[model samples]
Target: MSEISILKDFQKRQMLFMELYKKAFPAVARYISRKGGNYEEAKDIFQDALVIYYEKLISKSFSPINNEKAYILGIAKHLWIRKLGSNVINDTIESAESEAVFAEEHLRTDKLIYLLETAGKKCMDILRAFYYEKASITEIAQQFGYSGTRSATVQKYKCIEKIRETVKEKSLAYEDFIE
Candidate 1:
């Protein structure tokens, strides 16, 4: 195909993907909630499944052998099951179907964390100070010995932007957890 055709096709596929997500999201949410999971858990699982789907597509390792909905639902199912098996989640409310979704999401979260950590020490420190420590820009600047608070804030934003770009370039989604 020509470049323009490929681009158009890609856009079409993305739109289709979004439609599938819209349709599947409610079912996935109900499945999780019915199995004792909360709305938050459902959202987390769905987002992670989408990330996995994105990664697979970008890597060209995904096959359209099945419908997109089924493919994503399958990934979510696998995620839920792994979560149950790991004991991170109690199995009391878990159904066989729900387990797979939780498990796959758990794995995806782990993978995203790993990727964030591997971004580099500076990026990690900036993220931790801004996010985990909840420090003010001035305080962070003083601690890190930057020129001033403004510089510190700018640097922090830049670092996060870098991380975001890096994650995207690698076919990963960093926005959901990054802040």
Candidate 2:
């Protein structure tokens, strides 16, 4: 395939994953939460499920699943069980109990995320495009209206630096909270 065609295929897959994330992650996360798993675990399992789903979809002998949402959810559950066996009931229950101890810390993390979302959304968008969507510099430039690849690269670095500064500022408030 040509470079342009490869890029298009990647973008198409990114869109597919985005749609799947929107459709499937909330329910998966809720189930994880109810099972005493944290948000990070939920994210990990969901991402793994997407990888599996995407690979199957792209395989030469692909057999389409009937319901993608349910398919992804089932994959996520399987992965979660594999990662932490179903016998981890006590661990998960204890995790839920320990969450209350970290409630204050979670609030601080939430505040930092809020700042990132509100004050640095464009930067976050660029970073997300680069990291999460695996978008090429050229693609990111075109999408974000950057003049060129170099411009996009510069903007990406600047955004990373800006986010670092913002995170440092936020971290200062939690110096005591840290151990």
Number of the predicted model whose TM-score against the real structure is largest: 2
Candidate 2's displacement at residue 82, Å, is 0.8
Q: What lDDT tens digits, residue by residue, belong to model 2 across residues 45-79?
A: 88888878776766668775656766776677667
Candidate 1 runs further than 4 Å off: 1-14, 86-179
Q: Considering every candidate listed, which one attains the maximal lDDT?
A: 2
The digit string of per-residue lDDT tens for model 1 on 1-179 reads 53234325734544544465554555565556555676677767877877787666655554544445556665665576676665354333234335434433533344555666666777767666665345689888987899998999888888878777777777754233322
Clashing pairs in 2: none
Candidate 1: worst-modelled 10 consecutive residues by lDDT: 87-96
- Backbone collisions counted per model: 17, 0
The alpha-carbon RMSD values of the candidates against the true structure, listed in the order shown, are 14.5, 8.7
